[model samples]
Target: MTSVDQPPAFSDGAAVIELLNTSIGYGARAVVDDVSLRIDRGEVVALVGPNGSGKTTIVRGLLGLAPVVGGEVRLFGVPAGRFHERWRIGYVPQRHTVVGAVPSTVQEVVASGRLARRRWWKPPTAADRAVVSRAIDVVGLVDQSRASVSTLSGGQQRRVLIARALAADPEVLVMDEPTAGVDVASAEALTRTLARLVEDGRTLLIVTHDVAPLAPILTRVVAVAGGSVVGDEPARIALSPASALAGGIYAHPGHDPHHLAPDDPAGPAPGPGWLGDPGLRGAPAAS
Candidate 1:
C-alpha cells in the first residue's frame, strides 16, 4: 500500500481517526447517521452499546467494510477512501475461534498478519520472523507459539488473534468484542495484553458490550444508541462501577438514563447534562 502524496485540507493532524458527520450502512439503509467522532493518537476508546446499536457499524465504516453514505471518514490525515497505507491499522474481528476449518499453529497464524507488509511470493525474512515472535510475546503466547490453535483454550486463542494483529505493528488497533465469551481469567489476560499495548503508546478503538474488565485502562467511553452517540465521557466518569450500576452512564440503550421515570425514586430523572451533553444530546462535534 502506498501513502497519500498530500493530505486533504479537511484532515486533522491531531486525530488518528475522524468520522465527520458520517452515516454508514449496507446498500441503501443507514444504520448510523450524522455521527461525528475523533480518536487521537495514544487514546484507548471504547465503543459500548447493545447489539444492533450501530457500534459495529461505526467500526466497519472506519475499516471501509461498510458504505459511508454521508460526510467523511479520515485515517491518519487522509480520506479513508483514498488512504492506501492500510498497514497503519490492524483489526481483530469478533472471535468464534482462532483456528478455521484448517488448523494452524499459533506462530503460523501470527505470521500471517505480516502478509500485508510483504509480497506473497517473497519468503519470510529474519526481521519478519523476529517481528512475528515479538507479537506473540506481546500477547503472552510465546510458550504456546508452536501449539495448534485449535488445542488452546478460548482465551489463549483470542490472544493469538491479537498477536496476529500486533504482528503488523499498526499505528492503531481496532478490536471488536475482545472479551466476548471468554472466562474471567481469560478476560483479565486480555486486559493485561491491551494495557501493554496502551503503555507502548498505541491508539486503540475497541467495541464491546462488557466494559468492566477494561474500564481501568480506557481513556474514553462512547455510548451508542438509536443510530447515534448518546453519551461520550472520560472513562472514569462513564464507566465507573457506581454510574454503570445506576444506569447513569455507559448503560445499554434499554437502560438509558433518559428512560428512567422521574417519580420512580432511583435518583432524579436524568437530563441532557447526565450524559455530559453541552446542548446537543451527544458529544460536541469533533473540531
Candidate 2:
C-alpha cells in the first residue's frame, strides 16, 4: 500500500459514484476485483495508478458503458442500471475522436453536450441554445465559437471538448487524462479551468499520472493499483512538495513501457491518434 500523510476529507455530501461489490473483466476474465468506493458531490478527486490498474474499467462501469460482472454502481444516488443523471455528469475523454476530418464548428459541437437533457427525438429548445452559449462562454471559446474543431489548434480543440461537457452544466465532471497531450502552456491552462470548476462548487474526478503543475490546485488525490484504491489523501498533505507531477508524456513501465511522446516526429500527436496506440492494447492499466 502507498503511504499517505492524512485521511481524506469526506464532506461533499451525498455520493455521486459508488462501486459496491464491483468487479469487471473481459470474456469472463476478471481484471478488476470486488471494490467499493464513493465520490461525493462538490469534490475534486484524482484517481491514479500504474498500468492495468483498472482506471478506465472503473470509469466505464460508472458510466454504465461496460457490463458489471457482479455488484452495483450508483450515480447521483440512483442505481447504476436505472441511473438517468447523465446530464448531471460531464465526461472529457482522452481522445478528441469524432466523425470525419471535415471539422465541425466549436459551437455546433458544444451544443451536442446538451443532447442528454433533451427529450428523445425532439429538437433543441430555446433553453438548450442558451445553455450552449453559456457553456461556450465559460470555456473562453466565445471568440472561437465559429472556428472548426479540426482546423483549430490542439488546445482549442480541447477547449471545445471542455465546452461540450460544460454545456450540460453538470454537477460532476469526469476527465480521463485531461492533460496528456497538450503542451506545457496549454495543459497548465486546462488545469486552471478545472480549478475554477471547484471554485464554482462543481465536483470533478480525474485520472492522472502526475500531481505537479496542477497539484497545488487540487483538493484530493486517490491512487489505485491492481484494481483497488491504494491511497486517498488531501492534496495539501499527501503529495511530496518535491514530488514530480506526471504530464507532457509518460513512457511508463506502464501501459506502454516504450510509449513514445507525442512530439515523436514519427509518432502521432495527442488526440484520436492515440486510439490506435498498440502499446495501450497490451497495457490496459495505463488508461
Candidate 3:
C-alpha cells in the first residue's frame, strides 16, 4: 500500500460531519427528511440506498450543494454555512463532471484540487509538486500524468478525478459512485487506494451501490431507502457471509443526485463560490 503523508490531527471523539434531524431537498420537495448522522475522525462510513432514495441528497446537503431546509448541518463542529475551511474537505463528483469540451492534461486536472488551498498569485512550490506527484502515483497513473484527460478511458478518468481529490489531502473525502462503470481491475485498484487512505486516518463518506469492494474497511454502514436511513450496521456484521445470505449489505440503484436539471424547480440551484471552489461559483446562496 502506498503511504500517505502524516495527516493533520483531529480532535478525538469529535464528529467530522453531523446532521441532526436534517431535511434536505430542492425547494418544496424533501428528498431526505429528519436524517441524522455523525461521522467521526478516521471512520469509513458508507451510504447505501436505492435510486432517488436521498443518499446523494444527504451527501450534497453536507457539502452545501443541496438545500438544507431544516435541522442542523455541521462540519468539524462548525455550522456548514459558516465553515470556510473547505480545502480540508475533498469531493469527487461523478466521472462525467470533469468531462468537457475543454481538454486538460491529467496533471493539470489533478492540480486543480490545490487551487483552493494555494495562493492565487503564487506559483506552485516544491511541496505542492511533490504532493501532486504522490497523488498521481498512488492512483497508479504516473506514466499518464502528462497525458490529456480526454485521451484516457472512463475508468482512467475516474482515477484521475480521485487523484485530484487526493492532491488536496483532505481530512474528509466524499465520493459519489466512485466505482461506477469501472472494470474489475480498476475497481480493485480503487479499493486498495481507499484502504490506504483509510489506513492513513482519513475520514471517508462514500455513496455507492456496491459495497463489496469496500466492505472490509468500512467501519459503519448507513442504508437509506425511501429517503430515510433503514439500516445502520457495523462492518463485521454487514460483511459476514451470513449477512450476504440474508440479503446483502448494499441495496440496488444508488442514483447520482449531484446532477440537477436546469429546469428542476424544487431542487437546489447550486451554491455561489461556496467553500472556495470555483466550480460552484454560481450555486444557490446558503439558507
TM values, all candidates: 0.80, 0.78, 0.81
Best by lDDT: 1
Put the candidates in TM-score order, highest first: 3, 1, 2
Locate the minimum summed-lDDT window of 10 residues in model 1: 278-287
Residue pairs of candidate 3 with colliding backbone atoms? 26-266, 26-267, 27-266, 270-283, 270-284, 271-283, 271-284, 272-283, 273-281
For model 2 the TM-score comes to 0.78
Per-residue lDDT of model 2, residues 205-266, tens digit only: 88776444355356776767787766666655455433232221232323332332323344
What lDDT score goes with residue 241 in model 3? 41
| Residue 1 displacement (Å), model 2 | 9.3
Decoy 1 TM-score against native:
0.80
Give the total clashing residue pairs for model 2.
6
**Model 3 lDDT per residue over 83-163, tens place:** 998878899996654676887898999998878879989999999988888888777777788888888878778878888
Enumerate residue pairs that collide in model 2: 51-285, 51-286, 52-285, 53-285, 210-246, 212-245
RMSD (Å) of each candidate, 1 decimal = 11.1, 9.4, 13.1
